[model samples]
Target: YKAESGEIFAVNPICTHMKCDVKWNTSEKSWDCPCHGGRFDCKGKVLTGPPAQDLEVVNLEQLIEKDNS
Candidate 1:
Protein backbone atom coordinates (compact mmCIF):
# COMPACT_ATOMS: atom_id res chain seq x y z
CA TYR A 1 0.00 0.00 0.00
CA LYS A 2 1.18 3.57 -0.67
CA ALA A 3 0.77 6.05 2.10
CA GLU A 4 0.10 9.73 1.66
CA SER A 5 3.62 10.28 2.98
CA GLY A 6 4.93 8.58 -0.17
CA GLU A 7 6.00 5.42 1.57
CA ILE A 8 5.24 2.05 0.11
CA PHE A 9 4.31 -1.02 2.09
CA ALA A 10 4.05 -4.47 0.69
CA VAL A 11 3.60 -7.96 2.08
CA ASN A 12 2.85 -11.50 1.15
CA PRO A 13 -0.91 -11.57 0.63
CA ILE A 14 -1.44 -14.96 2.23
CA CYS A 15 -2.88 -15.12 5.70
CA THR A 16 -0.71 -16.90 8.21
CA HIS A 17 -3.69 -18.42 9.95
CA MET A 18 -4.91 -20.89 7.34
CA LYS A 19 -3.10 -19.81 4.16
CA CYS A 20 -6.19 -18.02 2.92
CA ASP A 21 -5.66 -14.88 0.84
CA VAL A 22 -5.80 -11.52 2.59
CA LYS A 23 -7.74 -8.59 1.23
CA TRP A 24 -7.06 -4.91 1.70
CA ASN A 25 -9.51 -3.00 3.82
CA THR A 26 -9.51 0.55 2.41
CA SER A 27 -11.51 2.05 5.22
CA GLU A 28 -9.37 0.40 7.88
CA LYS A 29 -6.10 0.69 5.92
CA SER A 30 -5.23 -2.85 6.84
CA TRP A 31 -4.81 -6.27 5.35
CA ASP A 32 -7.63 -8.51 6.50
CA CYS A 33 -7.94 -12.25 6.30
CA PRO A 34 -11.26 -13.61 5.17
CA CYS A 35 -10.78 -17.01 6.71
CA HIS A 36 -10.13 -16.31 10.38
CA GLY A 37 -10.32 -12.53 10.77
CA GLY A 38 -6.60 -11.98 11.08
CA ARG A 39 -5.60 -8.36 10.55
CA PHE A 40 -2.26 -6.81 9.68
CA ASP A 41 -1.02 -3.28 9.48
CA CYS A 42 0.34 -1.70 6.29
CA LYS A 43 3.86 -2.66 7.24
CA GLY A 44 2.72 -6.25 7.68
CA LYS A 45 2.79 -6.36 11.45
CA VAL A 46 0.08 -8.46 12.94
CA LEU A 47 -2.65 -6.29 14.35
CA THR A 48 -4.93 -9.18 15.25
CA GLY A 49 -4.53 -12.84 14.74
CA PRO A 50 -5.12 -16.36 14.54
CA PRO A 51 -1.67 -15.57 13.15
CA ALA A 52 1.23 -15.11 15.52
CA GLN A 53 3.75 -14.21 12.83
CA ASP A 54 3.78 -11.06 10.75
CA LEU A 55 3.46 -11.31 6.98
CA GLU A 56 6.71 -11.58 5.07
CA VAL A 57 7.81 -8.24 3.69
CA VAL A 58 8.28 -8.15 -0.04
CA ASN A 59 11.40 -6.47 -1.41
CA LEU A 60 10.11 -3.81 -3.74
CA GLU A 61 13.45 -2.88 -5.27
CA GLN A 62 14.26 -6.45 -6.13
CA LEU A 63 10.85 -6.97 -7.59
CA ILE A 64 11.17 -3.87 -9.73
CA GLU A 65 14.60 -4.91 -10.94
CA LYS A 66 13.39 -8.37 -11.83
CA ASP A 67 10.43 -6.99 -13.70
CA ASN A 68 12.69 -4.70 -15.69
CA SER A 69 15.04 -7.51 -16.60
Candidate 2:
Protein backbone atom coordinates (compact mmCIF):
# COMPACT_ATOMS: atom_id res chain seq x y z
CA TYR A 1 0.00 0.00 0.00
CA LYS A 2 1.10 3.60 -0.59
CA ALA A 3 1.22 4.21 3.11
CA GLU A 4 0.63 7.72 4.37
CA SER A 5 2.23 6.31 7.49
CA GLY A 6 4.05 3.03 8.04
CA GLU A 7 1.84 0.14 6.97
CA ILE A 8 1.64 -3.42 5.76
CA PHE A 9 -0.78 -4.76 3.14
CA ALA A 10 -0.70 -8.47 2.41
CA VAL A 11 -1.57 -10.27 -0.81
CA ASN A 12 -1.30 -13.64 -2.48
CA PRO A 13 2.08 -15.08 -3.36
CA ILE A 14 1.08 -16.56 -6.71
CA CYS A 15 0.64 -15.07 -10.15
CA THR A 16 -2.83 -14.93 -11.70
CA HIS A 17 -1.63 -15.82 -15.21
CA MET A 18 0.59 -18.70 -14.16
CA LYS A 19 2.11 -20.33 -11.15
CA CYS A 20 5.05 -17.94 -11.20
CA ASP A 21 6.66 -16.25 -8.28
CA VAL A 22 6.03 -12.56 -7.67
CA LYS A 23 8.48 -10.15 -6.11
CA TRP A 24 8.23 -6.69 -4.66
CA ASN A 25 8.99 -4.24 -7.46
CA THR A 26 10.58 -1.37 -5.62
CA SER A 27 10.79 1.02 -8.57
CA GLU A 28 7.27 0.44 -9.87
CA LYS A 29 5.83 -0.42 -6.46
CA SER A 30 3.94 -3.49 -7.63
CA TRP A 31 4.09 -7.21 -8.18
CA ASP A 32 5.70 -8.28 -11.46
CA CYS A 33 5.32 -11.21 -13.76
CA PRO A 34 8.25 -13.58 -14.27
CA CYS A 35 6.49 -16.04 -16.58
CA HIS A 36 3.86 -14.08 -18.51
CA GLY A 37 3.38 -10.35 -19.09
CA GLY A 38 0.97 -9.87 -16.22
CA ARG A 39 1.24 -6.89 -13.83
CA PHE A 40 -0.66 -6.35 -10.59
CA ASP A 41 -0.57 -3.37 -8.29
CA CYS A 42 -0.05 -3.46 -4.53
CA LYS A 43 -3.75 -3.98 -3.75
CA GLY A 44 -3.79 -6.72 -6.41
CA LYS A 45 -5.52 -5.01 -9.28
CA VAL A 46 -4.49 -6.16 -12.73
CA LEU A 47 -2.47 -3.33 -14.26
CA THR A 48 -1.39 -5.06 -17.44
CA GLY A 49 -1.55 -8.48 -18.91
CA PRO A 50 -2.49 -11.58 -20.72
CA PRO A 51 -4.16 -12.16 -17.40
CA ALA A 52 -6.44 -9.18 -17.16
CA GLN A 53 -7.69 -10.06 -13.71
CA ASP A 54 -6.47 -9.53 -10.20
CA LEU A 55 -4.57 -12.24 -8.35
CA GLU A 56 -6.61 -14.39 -6.02
CA VAL A 57 -6.08 -13.62 -2.37
CA VAL A 58 -6.35 -16.13 0.44
CA ASN A 59 -6.41 -15.61 4.14
CA LEU A 60 -2.90 -16.46 5.30
CA GLU A 61 -3.82 -17.53 8.79
CA GLN A 62 -6.62 -19.79 7.59
CA LEU A 63 -4.54 -21.25 4.80
CA ILE A 64 -1.65 -22.05 7.12
CA GLU A 65 -3.97 -23.67 9.61
CA LYS A 66 -5.62 -25.76 6.92
CA ASP A 67 -2.26 -26.89 5.58
CA ASN A 68 -0.95 -27.86 8.97
CA SER A 69 -3.57 -30.50 9.60
Candidate 3:
Protein backbone atom coordinates (compact mmCIF):
# COMPACT_ATOMS: atom_id res chain seq x y z
CA TYR A 1 0.00 0.00 0.00
CA LYS A 2 1.09 3.60 -0.60
CA ALA A 3 1.10 6.03 2.24
CA GLU A 4 0.56 9.82 2.02
CA SER A 5 4.30 10.22 2.54
CA GLY A 6 4.93 7.96 -0.51
CA GLU A 7 6.13 4.97 1.43
CA ILE A 8 5.05 1.56 0.15
CA PHE A 9 4.35 -1.67 1.99
CA ALA A 10 3.15 -5.06 0.83
CA VAL A 11 1.75 -8.24 2.32
CA ASN A 12 0.84 -11.70 1.22
CA PRO A 13 -2.71 -12.17 0.01
CA ILE A 14 -3.47 -14.95 2.47
CA CYS A 15 -5.24 -14.77 5.80
CA THR A 16 -3.31 -15.92 8.82
CA HIS A 17 -6.28 -17.56 10.48
CA MET A 18 -7.49 -20.08 7.96
CA LYS A 19 -5.12 -19.73 5.03
CA CYS A 20 -7.87 -18.29 2.90
CA ASP A 21 -6.97 -15.94 0.10
CA VAL A 22 -7.47 -12.27 0.99
CA LYS A 23 -9.00 -9.65 -1.24
CA TRP A 24 -8.05 -6.02 -1.35
CA ASN A 25 -10.59 -3.58 0.03
CA THR A 26 -10.04 -0.23 -1.65
CA SER A 27 -12.43 1.52 0.70
CA GLU A 28 -10.66 0.32 3.82
CA LYS A 29 -7.26 0.09 2.16
CA SER A 30 -6.78 -3.29 3.75
CA TRP A 31 -6.71 -6.99 2.97
CA ASP A 32 -9.91 -8.73 3.94
CA CYS A 33 -10.68 -12.39 4.30
CA PRO A 34 -14.13 -13.33 3.12
CA CYS A 35 -14.04 -16.57 5.05
CA HIS A 36 -13.63 -15.41 8.62
CA GLY A 37 -13.63 -11.61 8.75
CA GLY A 38 -9.91 -11.33 9.25
CA ARG A 39 -8.43 -8.01 8.20
CA PHE A 40 -4.89 -6.81 7.81
CA ASP A 41 -3.32 -3.46 7.10
CA CYS A 42 -0.90 -2.65 4.31
CA LYS A 43 2.12 -3.46 6.43
CA GLY A 44 0.56 -6.85 7.31
CA LYS A 45 -0.46 -5.88 10.81
CA VAL A 46 -3.70 -7.39 11.99
CA LEU A 47 -6.54 -4.92 12.04
CA THR A 48 -9.12 -7.49 13.10
CA GLY A 49 -8.87 -11.14 13.79
CA PRO A 50 -9.66 -14.62 14.30
CA PRO A 51 -6.09 -14.36 13.13
CA ALA A 52 -3.72 -14.33 16.04
CA GLN A 53 -0.85 -13.26 13.82
CA ASP A 54 -0.19 -10.82 11.01
CA LEU A 55 0.13 -11.72 7.35
CA GLU A 56 3.50 -12.23 5.74
CA VAL A 57 5.24 -9.28 4.15
CA VAL A 58 6.64 -9.85 0.69
CA ASN A 59 9.63 -8.22 -0.95
CA LEU A 60 8.58 -7.14 -4.43
CA GLU A 61 11.70 -5.43 -5.71
CA GLN A 62 12.64 -8.29 -8.05
CA LEU A 63 9.13 -8.70 -9.35
CA ILE A 64 8.75 -4.99 -9.98
CA GLU A 65 11.94 -4.87 -12.03
CA LYS A 66 10.94 -7.95 -13.98
CA ASP A 67 7.53 -6.51 -14.78
CA ASN A 68 9.06 -3.22 -15.87
CA SER A 69 11.41 -5.01 -18.22
Question: Using lDDT as the measure, which candidate wins?
Answer: 1
Residue range 1-69, candidate 1, lDDT tens digits: 999999999999998879999999999999999999999999999999789999999999999999999
Taking all chains together, each candidate's TM-score versus the true structure is 0.93, 0.70, 0.78
On TM-score, the leading prediction is 1
Runs of candidate 2 with Cα error greater than 4 angstroms are: 1-4, 58-69
State candidate 2's TM-score.
Answer: 0.70
Off by over 4 Å in 1: none
Least well predicted 10-residue stretch by lDDT in candidate 3: 58-67
Superposed on all Cα atoms, model 3 deviates from the true structure by an RMSD in Å of 2.4
Residue pairs clashing in model 2 are none
Single out the weakest 10-residue window by summed lDDT for candidate 2: 1-10
Query: Candidate 2: how large is its RMSD?
Result: 3.4
Candidate 2 accuracy as lDDT: 0.77
Candidate 2 lDDT by residue in tens digits, 1-69 = 445566556678588777787777888988888888688887778888877668776566787799999
Ranking of all candidate structures by their TM-score, best first: 1, 3, 2
lDDT of 1 at 45: 96
